[model samples]
Target: MSSEQLAIRIEGLSKHFSVYHSPLERLKHVVFPGRTKGFNDFRALNNVSLSVKRGETCAIVGQNGSGKSTLLQILCGTLRATEGTIEVNGRIAALLELGAGFNADFTGRENVYMNGAVLGLTRAQIDERFADIEAFAEIGDFMDQPVKTYSSGMYVRLAFSVAIHVDPQILIVDEALAVGDSRFQAKCLNRIKAMKAEGVTILFVSHDVGAVRTLCERALWLDKGNVRMLGDAFSVTAQYNQFLFEADNEAVPTSAPKQIEESIPQENSAEPPDAQQAMKLHRPINHWGSHVGSIIEAGIFNQQGERSSVYTAGEPLTVRIRFEPPDHADRNTMSVAFSMKDLRGTDLIVSTTWDQNPTGFAAGNGPLVAEFRLPNHLNAGDYLLAVALEDRSGVLPQYYEYIEGAHYFSSLTEKKQYGTFLAQVSQSVHA
Candidate 1:
């Protein structure tokens, strides 16, 4: 790619740190000057490479301690890479860890000027944009107070406002947006959208799957200080989510005895459903609980009473869940529930058996079967299902088993619909 089109470039990037047992070991290493240094070398980033084009919005996503912060610090020059090369063609502003660049004793106004100067702005330049920054921050009189007195949200607001007003060509945001309230988060997203439209490149790091898919065109998935996947945001996030599900399932302790099994079978009113096809399209299945019970099978059936993974818009649908409860389970107050999420990872609908009987439910003494009539009129799209069983007998409910991505299905349509819902329309001409 042409140099002008490249906003950031990294090659063979890596960061390493010395892991010492204690301060004594570190001091001993300094005195002895041995090859081992009385510590182990920990590689936080390993041979990572990626590129971002000017004006493109990109994201870095992963579980905690996956080298995400290290990579960003290297990009922002807050930490030096132990190996490799990095290139930046324009001015960069970053909102990293909380209270990273501000002095606690300095007033917000003073910090603003100091941060602006650090970002390559002169006193006159800061003065010209100071009013706009203050207005955007919306902290009012807090600007005159010491930053130490500011709440976490207030600090984020002022820092974000100052960073944006400095006319940075590249902006890096690390999960600091979580500190802001919903309204402020919305405002920040809108401002970031406007900045993207104005040809500013953005590097965002967030755990919010919806935000990552909506705002970024591309994503980089990091794992154990290595690049696991890098591609379109939707595909990357999908893979990342599946990875999380599998990881969680694996994290369940195997010491518990297997006391539950699938007792009921899915109905066979017609030809057998394609299990492999359904598995391929559906999100990964994850379960967790005390192992008192388990869901054996989950199926989606059309109005014809035939199991299927595809449906038509506005068609009647049913979700059949068969679960096996061990003898230790509480039968009188147990409940089953399910939730549906769209492709964007947004929960569109959720329902529980307790909705019909608020007090509780008694499943009697046989295998449990839950059949829920799902609402029609969902917009044409793919959706994933999550199911769980819980006991509501006491003040604190206990989950027996909660399985995520239990089923996946799609609603097809001939007519174009906007958003995730197809609303019935009726109108009359007044003129």
Candidate 2:
């Protein structure tokens, strides 16, 4: 059989949870098995079926409570499936949680053997791989100390290093790959790549669609315990993201959300998907903010209307904002503002263009752009350009975007620090 030949098969899989009352209900269960605690039961996984072939990298994705972790736990045998069947033909190594299976009281070396043997490695096999695992973990002298004494970073290092070197035929990895530092994450990702090269089948689960897009060939998306999609990683991720927005009301803008699993279509269904063949980075998705008055579209450009990919510090970056009024405004007043913020949505810029400079709008819809030139003496980082047209002026900015990490640029050269939005300055040398 080819590497793509079936390594694992799933059919009619599902799981459910009790509604909002699981905690009280669990207590009741211990006291009274016959009487249920809550009026409604939450169905976590509904009829879901999927397949994975040998040497394939498959990812599971969804928002919280979307049954992603539930499915992975079932596959890892930590949780029993409420229904359906899963079949696999391979020796397996699983990383279901961060720092799982290690006794905090035990040393790293002891936990390594315990974890290795749980994967069915013989003592000799564990010994042979032990040195490599230790070096990869890079915990140094801490390996001899109890795990509880280790930092969270150290815990992740030891846990991840032990799991990867077991040489299993199939690797089931949850989000544990994200626990360590960026450099360690790069290292672990490289190892996953090496495993893929060596024909190891992998089933990965993560909320990080970027990592899933970068690592996996195919993907499965679950929503409220039912299988929403099983297709190319990008396509399924997009659908999963849509459900995430629907599930969370606070997940505003709908186009983008925090830790969003944004996606485009995959170029191929049959071959293992590569990130280059996965999706276009630029998205055509339009956005709407909380607005009594309306601002429909937002776009980025230069003054010439031609789009340029690269912008230098202290140069000019222009953004065009489009809007219209449903009815004639009594005041007919609005504000268009731009802010530079990090990915976390923290306010880096408390300033707006309209407050300082003036732009006028007539009754109906028209194309209007507020422009700001890049100042040279700024930090290097990514930023979002936010513009809005509110019903009222200076008081309350109603129609707000917080456009969710829209425009991003980097410093061509980093002289001192890791930051965006360089400080605006003027010179008056000790005269």
Indicate the residue-level lDDT of 221 in model 1: 95
Counting only residues 3 or more apart in sequence or on different chains, how many pairs clash (N, Cα, C under 3 Å) in candidate 2?
Answer: 12
* Model 1 lDDT per residue over 228-271, tens place: 98877766776677577557556544235344333222222222
Candidate achieving the largest TM-score: 1
Query: Which window of ten consecutive residues has the lowest lDDT sum in model 2?
Result: 259-268
Candidate 2 vs. true structure, TM-score? 0.61
For model 2 the local lDDT of residue 98 reads 60
- The whole-model lDDT of each prediction reads 0.80, 0.65
Candidate RMSDs in order: 6.1, 10.0
